[model samples]
Target chain A: MKKFVQVEDVGMRFDTKKGPFVALRDVDLAIEKGEFIALIGHSGCGKSTLLNLIAGLTVPTDGVLICDGREIAGPGPEREVVFQNHSLLPWLTCFENVYLAVERVFGAKEGKPKLKLRTQEALALVGLTHAEQKYPHEISGGMKQRVGIARALSMQPKVLLMDEPFGALDALTRARLQDELMKICDATGATVVMVTHDVDEAVLLSDRIVMMTNGPAATIGEILKVELPRPRNRLELAHDPRYIDYRAAVLSFLYEKQAHHEKQAA
Target chain B: MSAITFEKALEAGAAAAVAEPAVVAVARSEPAASAASTASVASSAVPVARDGGAPSPKPESRAGEWLRAAARATLPPAIGLAVMIGIWYLATLSAGGSLPGPVQTWEAAVKLFADPFYSNGPNDQGIGWNVLSSLQRVGIGFGIAALIGIPLGFLLGRFATLSSMVNPIISLLRPVSPLAWLPIGLLVFKKADPAATWTIFICSIWPMIMNTAQGVTRVPSDYMNVARVLNLSEWKIFTKILFPAVLPYMLTGIRLSIGTAWLVIVAAEMLTGGVGIGFWVWDEWNNLKVEHIIIAIFVIGIVGLLLEQMLIAIAKRFSYE
Candidate 1:
């Protein structure tokens, strides 16, 4: 598989009142083109820091990140991010939110009047045709997340970065949205780099799950390839043998890490 | 029912109100007041009283309750104002000179406006011109402050280290009174009107600058992250995201700043001796025209109120949700 997003020995640190806190350490990961990759670990395990690095929101303390064989210097239209909070501009309606991105990417460029239609199509893809006129505050949490997805997809990005997009949702709502996300991914063929805590969600949606060690100095502990077939059904995916095995492996890895952490504390 | 028993009974009644299908036998065992209160309580708790026993708290009820609630809330201030007016009348009656009562003040206001615009020749202009001059100075000073404050606020908001570094300097300069800046402004400009206006601008700009910076900094981290994720250009993030998010705060700042401008301009005008409401008040005081001074005070207050309302309307228009 062709490597589409590469983080080459990237490290990130923050100078704190106590001392220098390492957010990420020597993190190297290559995402194949069109692959759904999940970066999973405990809170503050640098999963988000790594995602931000990939999104070019922040510079790495050391090393480089490459996207489509070019150095990733800053945010661009090609790598759109869907934040955990959905981050829909409160003042903008759902359609306007998506259209804003579409307009910025295509409308501002030379000779592009069809951007409006593309925005509508993207909103429709996220099943928000009827809600195009509604503001973010007027919508449900799940719908807001959908708008976030629509806005990102509207850019026609090469890589879609989701930072725990469903983490705030209720369990049932989260599951339904996860299923919707998987279908959207199948259709878009855009490579996804999502950070999530739910093991089942990661397994069900991703082609590979990258687990990181706990931070202070976080690093990638394992990158397990999920062999589940495409067009995944949440119910059927959970029942599948490979899905169960992946879940067990991830859970055990987390448990062993927790035990190691306790020992270190003692 | 005894007092304790009545309390238990109301609780029991409330519980029964939700569950029972028909009339709840009010343990007629309670006091009349308790019964009435309980029945009213049932109107709230039952939603639909099982037996339809008690009259629902009146069908014209909510409106009546709302009116009563509003009256209860507003009555104190209304009474207080009336009492204050009465006391002022009594005080004026007790000590008479040309000491104006509310009626005298009203007459003075009317007399001032009745002529509207006056020029008894050079060296004389009616309050209309005075008010116009004051408003013009406020507009110019406020405009200058806003033009500079907003951009500086955005810069301070966007750059964290710069904001932290500049915070001390801003703090140190912020508390020094406009009166203090007045002399410096007068010295620099070497003219009264420009100096007075500059003092107004200097005084007013701080709130707008601080509020704008605060608004910018507080532009939800989620929004910035969205900007990053979507790969929105810096310009889009500023115009679309940061601008709207911080607008309410900036508007509030502007509102506060304008008030400060009005305050400082009046003081500056008093010191510098010019054509403004402040100068009119000071000039009337100098002439010992107490009635005219009272009229000028009223005019200043009314104008300030209108200005604040205008700003509030703008803030409301731009408010999200």
Candidate 2:
């Protein structure tokens, strides 16, 4: 499979008064077209930092990132990110939030209602056709995350980046939205790189889960291909033998990394 | 801990923190988790079509709706005036002063409005004329301040270094009394026309400037990041994102400015000895007309309240999502 996005030995660092802190060090990864990849790590493991670099919201301190065969320079409509907080403008209704991105990316020259059609389509795609006029504050946490997804999808991006989009939501809502998101991915075939801490959510949603080590400077510990068939049911997949091994593998990788860090600290 | 024990510990901790009836109070005051679960179920039963539907208005009877609308639109001072008069009538009977009651005040208010023109003698302008003059001065001063302050505020706010540099100067000027500025303004402008207005401007601009800067600085980090991520042009960011984001604060500042303007306007008028509510009050005090002074005080309060309410209404419209 051809690489759709490439992170070529990318390294990122932040300057603080204390000293220079490395978030990611000499990390390289490739994501293929139409692939759903989950990157999981604890906070400060630079999962979001890596996602931001790939999205071109921040430049890597060393090396390069390429998206859709082009060197990434800055954020554009092609690499849309649905942030962890949902980042929905509180003032805009669900439809309007989606419409805003659509208008910015593809508004009519005549200023006629081009945004309305795309926004309506995006909301419908997210199963939020009726929630078009409701503000972010008016919606449930899960629904707001859905609106964030709709807003990102409305941009018609090549790579959709989700930064723990369902982390704030309740368990049931998160599960339901996860199901809807899978349906969205299957329909659109848009490649996704989602950052999550939930082992179940990652297992259920991704074609592969990339687990990262804890950071003083973090790197990918392992990438496990999830061979679970598509239209995967979370509860059903939990019962499957293959999923059980996959969960154990990911958990052990995380646990092994934790033990290594604790030994280092001691 | 095992996941089940973790769950149990959390539940037990919550339960033990509150006594039984106190737990009931918490449950009643806040809808229970079960209620939210039920609501979610009920919500899902509604077709997804209703999720993004137009927001439901607060339920109210037709008459009640009309009354709420009226109350929202009504001037607070007018409502305050009615209440004050009701209290005043009771007070007058109890105090048994030679002073008149609500009926007498109404009669006085009516007589002042009856002539509808300037008085023949010097320093004897009608209340209406005096109010208009005061308004004119406030308008000029406030207009000048807004023109100067808002742009400067935007600049100061957008640049942290610049704000730090200018902040000390602002602090220095802000605390100095508006009354102190009145004498300086009188000396500097050396004319009643602009100088009196300048006093109002200096006093009023402090709040507008500070609040506008605060508003600009306090624009949500998420929105700023969104603006940055989009790589929006500076002008586009200012007009579309920055301006709208800071609008509520600007309006709030304007309301505060108006109140300051009114406060300073009267003082300015008293010092300048020109035609305004403040001048009217001072002139009445000189003549020892206590009733006229009371009337002027009421007028100032009513006008100030109306101005603030109008600004509040405008702010509310733009601030709500």
Candidate 3:
């Protein structure tokens, strides 16, 4: 498989008053181009820390992260993030929020009209054209997340990183957004690394699931490739033995192997 | 019924502004027949014109409701004022008229406002002139503070070391009364007006810096992450994200600073012996014109209230939520 994003011997350590806190260590992963990869782990397992590393929001204490054959120095529009809280700037209209991203990424080469067109197109893609003029607060949680997705995709980044994008939403909204995300991925052919705890979501959306061991020093314990064909339906997958087996493998790994001690402590 | 519809339309806020002209235009250019057709489509908006986008029922009732709301909002303040005045009148009567009653104050107010802009000499001027001179000083002092303080606030908020160094100094200086600086101002400027303004500056600068620094530091880490992920230039981050995000906090600082400036200007002017409301109040008291002094108090209060309300309205307008 062709690697689009390369993470080599990545480790992260945060300094606390007590001592040095090791979140991730010896974590190595290579994500292919146009691949849907899910980083799955229990809470406080540094799944988000790893995603932030990939997004270049945080520098790994050790090792290197490279995107599109270039060393990731710091965060750039090339690596876009859809944050957990749907971190849309509340002051801006949904259109303006996405437009800010579009302007940053393409504004240098593109004219004003083209930038606007890109913003409108991105909003339309997320089915939020009607809410383009509304502020983030006026919209529902699901809608805000959609706008968050729109803002990220509007950048047309090389790799899309989402840290628990739908984690805050209701189950129905989460399911609906998962489907929307799958469609967006299929259409854009963008490499995506999403951190999610939902086992079903991992199997449904990701080409491969990267589950981590429990922290002090968390590392990739298992990488399961879902061989399900494209356009998989959730209803049909419920009864699919392969899907059940994949879910069980992740569930057992999380509960039995890793345990939930870190979460309890946190 | 038409009254209700118009009021409901006003509450809707969608077609509210244009609708009046549209209503007038329809009345003029189109026939009454066409106007009736559009009216049905207009009322279905938030009534929330909430769910069914259908014609509204009895917006006439909404007008009554709006009026009732207005009354509900205003009644308490009016009643509270009345009660306070009644107590004042009773107290004045009981104490053998040492303090002026509400009616006496009202009469004095009317006479004082009759020619508020009159100018007799350098020391003798109308209440308006006094108020304006005071405002001019406050404006100069507060403007200078804002020019320096807001940017410094951003820096303090951004750099922890700088904030740490300055935070102790601010904590020490902030509690020193605005008038306490008046002597220092007098010693430096060697002029009454600049001295008064300096007092205002020293008093006002603290809030602007403190609040702005607080705003900058309190900026949601999420926004900073957005800036980082976008790889926005330092200028872009400041202009687009940081500026807008921190604006409410900055305005809050401005509001607080202006309030302190206004408050300090009065006392500073009294000490500095300038042509200001505070000086006028002292002048009136020395002349044994207590009623005029009372009138000055009301004028000062009303002006302060107006200034506060203006800032509040601006804050409300700019608020993201």
What do the candidate models score in CA lDDT, each in turn?
0.81, 0.79, 0.84
- Per-residue lDDT, model 3, residue A146, is 98
- Tens digits of per-residue lDDT for model 3, B1-321: 332333233223323324454334323322222233235333432254233323358655665565456555644554444334444544554567667766577677778889999999978899999999999998999999999999999999999999999999999998988888888888998999899998888888998998888999888999999888878789988988888888999999999998888887778877878699999998988887887888888788888888899999999988886
Total clashes for model 1: 4
After superposition, which runs of candidate 2 have C-alpha atoms over 4 Å from their true positions? A108-113, A259-266, B1-118, B187-190
Q: Residue A39 deviation, candidate 3, in Å?
A: 1.1
lDDT of 1 by residue, B143-232 (tens): 998999888888898889989998899899999998898888878999988888888888888998899999988988888777776666
**What TM-score does each of the candidates earn?**
0.81, 0.79, 0.87
Better of 2 and 3 by DockQ: 3
Evaluated with DockQ, which candidate comes out highest? 3
* Candidate 3 Cα outliers beyond 4 Å, as residue runs: A260-266, B1-71
The pairs that clash in candidate 3 are B4-B59, B4-B60, B45-B48, B45-B49, B46-B49
How high is the TM-score of chain A in model 1?
A: 0.95
How well docked is model 2, in DockQ terms? Answer: 0.23
Taking the tens digit of each residue's C-alpha lDDT, what string does model 3 give over A120-178?
99999999999999999999999999999999999999899999999999999999999
| Clashing pairs for predicted structure model 1, backbone only | A81-B229, B1-B29, B22-B51, B23-B51
lDDT of 3: 0.84
Q: What is the lDDT of residue B260 in candidate 3?
A: 81
Give the DockQ (2 decimals) of all models: 0.55, 0.23, 0.61
